[model samples]
Target chain A: MQKIVPNISVDCVIFGFDFKQLNVLLVERKLQDEKTGETLIDDWTLTGYHIFEDEDFDTAAARILKGLSGLDNIYLEQFYAFGKVSRVDSPKDNIWLKHQHEGFSSRIVTVGYYSLIDNSTVTLQLQERNVKWFSITDLPELGFDHQEILNKALEKLRSKLRSEPIGFELLPEKFTLSQLQKLYEAILGTTYDRRNFRKKVLQMKYIIPLNEKQKAVKHKPAQLFIFSRDVYERTKRERFDFSI
Target chain B: MQKIVPNISVDCVIFGFDFKQLNVLLVERKLQDEKTGETLIDDWTLTGYHIFEDEDFDTAAARILKGLSGLDNIYLEQFYAFGKVSRVDSPKDNIWLKHQHEGFSSRIVTVGYYSLIDNSTVTLQLQERNVKWFSITDLPELGFDHQEILNKALEKLRSKLRSEPIGFELLPEKFTLSQLQKLYEAILGTTYDRRNFRKKVLQMKYIIPLNEKQKAVKHKPAQLFIFSRDVYERTKRERFDFSI
Candidate 1:
């Protein structure tokens, strides 16, 4: 067996958006209480694993998330490193850590990574009944410092969305401007003037206009648009225009 | 001695600006070779130490720099995690590690932190003839993966300066407008039109104008200003304006 690096692990905060609400993927662990002989709190955590010796940190993050999203090349951006000595607070957490690795402690520092993906298109392999999606606002009791990790991830995502055109990763190929505005509102936890938002974004040449519109909606269909990667990549080298 | 964490370390990229150029602190290690009975590369490395079992990563980073800077409250921001199997490629590194702790391997994950400080005020304590500052552009051969760590720290610093008002940390209590512009140009590696730069920044409410200018300059003196911390703190919660 490969000798895993002692006292180190990688955790990922995978964010998913369905054009309306933001969600994150979390894993539940099974641990037993010694006195009662009963299953303890099913603590939820960001899906992660101990990194192997051969791969770099980026590759290790992707390795933990390989078969879950169905898509192979997920962009995982490392944001922060959580290194509180007491991150794994309770006795139950230590038991869970033992379950993952014999003679283990979650005192390890975790390199935090986050990515936004389209929720409807990919197949989410939950791995038995453990992994599930919880609303960003309604998270359950988390294990370790995973809650702190999630908040930092959200802060990073908000900052990233303000600077880059990464918000397109969360939406479908073609989306209405209203849907785009709502996506930003969800992530930023704020409201925007629809007319002003439309005016500013419409002036940008990168958000290409599409021919199709919503088919089954009751109200009049708004025009669809797609983010132009060719222009985004080229102009990304030049200067930023689409900022919050 | 307290048990140091196995296979884990904290490295700091202590960036100091002396008005003209950016400099980083590095330490040189001396070790004799086993076979030829000669000294090795005299490798330069970031001033770092192994994490204590009970200490958090930030505390560990601050602890390493505290003795060197002679300042107890060294703010160390965790930026990146460097995890590579071959990070300690040279035989000399392994030998040095063994000297520090028996049965030591370089398969360690190092958490990277960078901090900016004004060079003139603080007295830097160089351990032996070992620690010294070199210009960021003119770095020499570094030990292990320190050069890579330095590069990553610079990248993070640039991005951070673009979004936040962190550039003030490098400046004195008060500075001329030209000094501020030069700081940006130095960090970004690009020149900005003087008139446009001043006009844009003067419009900002946070850059408070002071009743002072250059005292002993031969040329015409420029007016000085200070970044208002109250305004910066209040506005930091809002959207960002100072960006690239």
Candidate 2:
């Protein structure tokens, strides 16, 4: 008797900020069929992979990140598990479908994980076809239900931003209050009173003022601030509400 | 070229309270060997299933609960994803291996979900095997990493208990302050100051004192209280710190 097993995989939508817009890492589908000579070169999606029989889910996520982006020790969080049976389009008509076996179907259950990385530090090799970063707001139609996955990740990110100091991960090590406010505004997709935002952020005491200021902006250079890791660690143990 | 596809599955651990202790639903695993005519009887595990290729994970979870427990619309939440290779111990050296094909390997990734059900309303049937409720504290050695999954679910339960009005799910529709307090103590594993606990709960203003009292208690007949759903829904939308 053949034992039936469920296949598991992990997908990650890495988000970063370029001081103006939110961007996500995406890769073009590389697998193609030679017999029919068809390709899905334009269908881009998040970096994902199958969970090997022996690997743990978190380990599989880290391994996928390492394999695709060549980055390690990045903070990765499990967001949602996508288990809609037909999330992937049918392979029968898909050029990529010819690459798979006949009896097997595209029944993928993927756990979505999101990571925040500094885009400047990332060295894009384009090793896996057309791997690139696209503005999240202007993303093209994704291959699978990746657009939905990305939206869910953004919601998680917004909720996380309220309680945790995760926004720092999307910005540079040293940044200005305006930059921080802009990042929050972009993520929340709402306008905030600048004075109130600064006041609230200052009250949290998670950010420390640096002596340096932003140098290249056309307007008045804003004072730079760095996230106080020690302060964040200490305050995290205490219950503080940052709902607003 | 062979195309690789992933299979998806959902596993649920339903929890209930029996006034004295916390319990979890388990199903017996029946193993029979064709070669030696041997059988391993009464092996118990969580209720699980392979999600059809086109079903949503949440939908599959609801279906599994309805199929196994004949219950729906219960308080369910996703806890963790288990993707460890070799999670299922092979019985290759056992008598059952003789009936199975060689070089056959099964890799399964199971997402763990949990539901809080009223113990009194749980109607059990020996659908698959011997279904029984075991005290969570004294659960039998479960298959694979189910024990770990249960622990994570309990942690999530505890966290949700502090933030939401989930204790009502574990208790009767009408309950006393002491019963409510005991439920919290059981879930949190900590003894609370009786006066302080009552005061804090009262301050939340989401519990309504009913026009009745417990009749058969050993001590004073405590005033019955019911969670005010309207108040809870309203308060949940606002930011309230439940750190203490």
Candidate-wise lDDT, in order = 0.79, 0.72
Q: Least lDDT summed over 10 consecutive residues: which range in candidate 1 chain A?
A: A235-244
lDDT of 1 by residue, B1-244 (tens): 8888777889989988776778888887777667997886587888877888899988888888887887776556788888877887777777677777754545777889997777757757675647778888788789888989999999888877777787878778788878888777777777888998888788777899998887888999989899887876766455632111
Those runs of model 1 whose alpha carbons end farther than 4 Å from true positions after fitting are: A1-3, A30-39, A98-101, A216-219, A237-244, B29-39, B91-103, B213-222, B240-244
Error of 1 at A41 (Å): 1.0
Q: What is the lDDT of candidate 1?
A: 0.79
Worst 10 residues of 2 chain A by lDDT: A235-244
Considering only N, C-alpha and C atoms within 3 Å, which residue pairs clash in candidate 2?
Answer: A7-B7, A53-B85, A54-B85, A85-B53, A85-B54, A85-B55, A86-B54, A100-B3, A101-B3
TM-score of each: 0.89, 0.74
Best by TM-score: 1
Model 2, B236: alpha-carbon shift in Å?
Answer: 4.4
Docking class of 2: acceptable
